[model samples]
Target: MLTVELGEELLIIKSEQPLKVLSSAMLNPGIGRYQYFVNRTVDKNYYPEDAKCEYEQFLQQYTMPLQMTVAMMTAVQQRFVMREQYVDGETTIDVFITAGLGNAVDVTQSYQYTYKPAVGTINIFVFVDGDMSDEAFIQAYHCIIEAKVKVLHERGVIDKQSGTIATGTSTDSVALAVKERGEFHAYGGSITRLGALIGKGVAATLHKAIDGYDAYQKGELR
Candidate 1:
């Protein structure tokens, strides 16, 4: 099973047993750096305590109940009034998304503003149960990416050959946690379930985030 806990700044994803974990993030130069690596999970200590503490402190300065956090949680489940902490995939999957669309762009007109920097970024983390091959993992990642772009297009933020809606952002990260040695085909049999749910989760979340951005830009969010 996978465990997901949403903190003020960080999103903690872990598995019940030892599994393989891969994480990547594109961060700004001054905020800090995230080391990329592929490692087997023997225990639940994935992130460093000190860095985690600093992240929380940094997050406190922002407004409470972050819109990104709310969007992510809301994607997987309906209703955000009870401070609900998770979206259970019935032990099959767990996904989380964080969005900051301050630098959002219309893929068609991004060339007009190439020199400007993005104000924020989005990070998504996913956890899946079952033993999967390296190929399967890569395929899953691609599925998630495809879903993200599709969502952006659905909102008119992206168009055919218009590039990406998150062009100027510094970080758009994805972390996948897959269980080790399980009862699943390792030779590319059935990875659709994993990909499909993740796609749905991301699409729903990104739609909400984009909607929020539109509201703010029109002076309706405040």
Candidate 2:
């Protein structure tokens, strides 16, 4: 590690022989007299401006879909209260719209949360990243809620201490959903993070498509 003092900031460069390389550095008069390579041993080179243009073009595709996703989140939060502190830490996504296929109506926004108590009358927070259509969102949501509730019930996430049906103001988990229809929904419905996983099913489809009719033998793809 070697520190070279730039005009304002010091940049640390890693090299086997920093001082020797710096001594033989050539000051290229491009944009500014910035020494990109320590020595004249760079395999290839291009003008900085050219490289910048290429990078900017490459980044344009990712910008729109990510932006669309987040913008929808903000709008949804105003009406539907979801998991508080959604999209916290870990992987923070920045989505921008790539394209809206036909009448698909870009309802691609989503958010996630992990409530501590996980049940009872509580507000589930959501952090969205795009604008969503109300019709599509509701349709997807109700389907998910019903499916999850059934699965959760079968999986024993909701069951009374007694063997009989839970009734008479003794709503534990089911009551939570009834009270907070928009928030704290049981199981996952539309507009849930599970959709993200489902979205990635495209990758699996592509893999299968590309590898279809493969000639594999001896535990190796051919």
Candidate 3:
């Protein structure tokens, strides 16, 4: 079973079974300055010695619960936090995003200037209730990335060269949780709807984050 909690300054996901954190980025410690923030906030002692070196265990034990708090407290804090719940008949998809863009950039301009190490970070977590296959997971990931880039572009945060999202290092991350089915094993039923909902939710959440960035730039928000 999967559980969610929204606290005064944190959002947490508690699960009975171990969940996977899958992304091309290095979320184990995050990237650049974001990496330092995660390292400072996470309780390394939380994990057993045996699991200390394991990335997945570290996330489940440390990052998932503590990173939110850390992001909230950091000086160049995360500007936006959004959560969306999508329901289609019996299936449900929940999307969560936390964006920190202090190192944001225009992908087009990346090549022109010798920039610093890591770029901004976006943490996306998706929870689903349904059965799915490995292939479906890959395709769904593609959908999430596309939607994220689209939202960045629509909100005027794209790279000048790529015309997509600004290029970054191993900072962005994603966590996908799926529920298991009973005796009769079947798949491919929820991918399409789940993908659509996840995409829309992620895009909308990112837009909100962009709004915060705009406000900060205008000195309306801190």
Candidate 4:
């Protein structure tokens, strides 16, 4: 089962197919969503380029429930701390699952839904230590933390406890938090690949979670 939770929002994927990411194309909304050529404004804070710096990202035809994407989404969320003023606020984000455009540069695309801003698809809510509502950041953190823990658990980089999160620590704190006790296995190569997936997935999921307004009724929004 693949679960995506933001605050109280939830998106559970129980499909037999593994979560897949075909591609990642990015566009920045600079001038309040109505301005043209937003990314070309040429101002410091007007529109900063993506931290990744890649114009387009293409992925293997992996299945859904992409644990990596989930991890990245979590990290992006944690990148910012909400301030009393909106300037300190985080940017809104969304994710789309398009079935087409799998094998073409000039392909047509269809978006699936407008993900609600909350973490989970459900309506549950969370309160951070402060009176801030940075649920997006918190949820993204959870995704990275969980995905790292999962990776370390698989690679035996950290010890884990059965029926619970891992018990040992890794240089990667997120992975360490999910430590468990089990047979030690070392696969640094595989672990590295998985770690990349977790990191990017966290960012993507963060964008999708806060993207679109009517994501729950994805069909309607589409």
Cα lDDT tens digits for candidate 1, 1-222: 444444433344434444455555322111111222111111112234564344444445644322112111111111111111123243355555545554455545656554353344445655565666777777767776777667755665531234555432333556655665544534322246556666666667666655665665687755
Candidate 3 lDDT over 1-222, as tens digits, reads 556655434455565554433444333332111111121122312234543344344446554544332221211243245667776656677776766565556655667766544435666766566655666666666777777767766655554344556643224656555554421123332256656666776677767766775686689976
**Which candidate ranks first by TM-score, i.e. highest?**
3
Find the 10 residues in a row with the least total lDDT in model 3. 31-40
lDDT of 2 by residue, 57-172 (tens): 43355322211111110111111121111132231211111110111111111112222211121111111222233443343334422433332333333223333221111111
| Model 3 stretches astray by more than 4 angstroms | 1-11, 24-79, 105-114, 158-170, 182-191
Off by over 4 Å in 2: 1-119, 147-151, 161-222
Each candidate's clash count:
0, 26, 2, 51
Estimated TM-score for each candidate? 0.56, 0.21, 0.63, 0.19
Instruction: Please name the candidate that would achieve the greatest lDDT relative to the true structure.
Output: 3
Please list the C-alpha lDDT of all candidates, in the order they appear. 0.46, 0.22, 0.52, 0.23
* Candidate 1 runs further than 4 Å off: 2-5, 26-91, 105-113, 158-170, 181-191, 209-222
Tens digit of per-residue lDDT, candidate 4, span 1-222: 122322221122232222222111122211111111101101122222563342223112323222333211211121121111111122211222211100111001112232222221101011111111223333433545454334334433311112233312211112111111222112212233223333444334423333332243355443
| Candidate 3 or 1, higher lDDT | 3
Weakest ten-residue segment in model 1 by summed lDDT: 73-82
**Order of all candidates by TM-score, from best down to worst?**
3, 1, 2, 4
Candidate 4, overall lDDT?
0.23
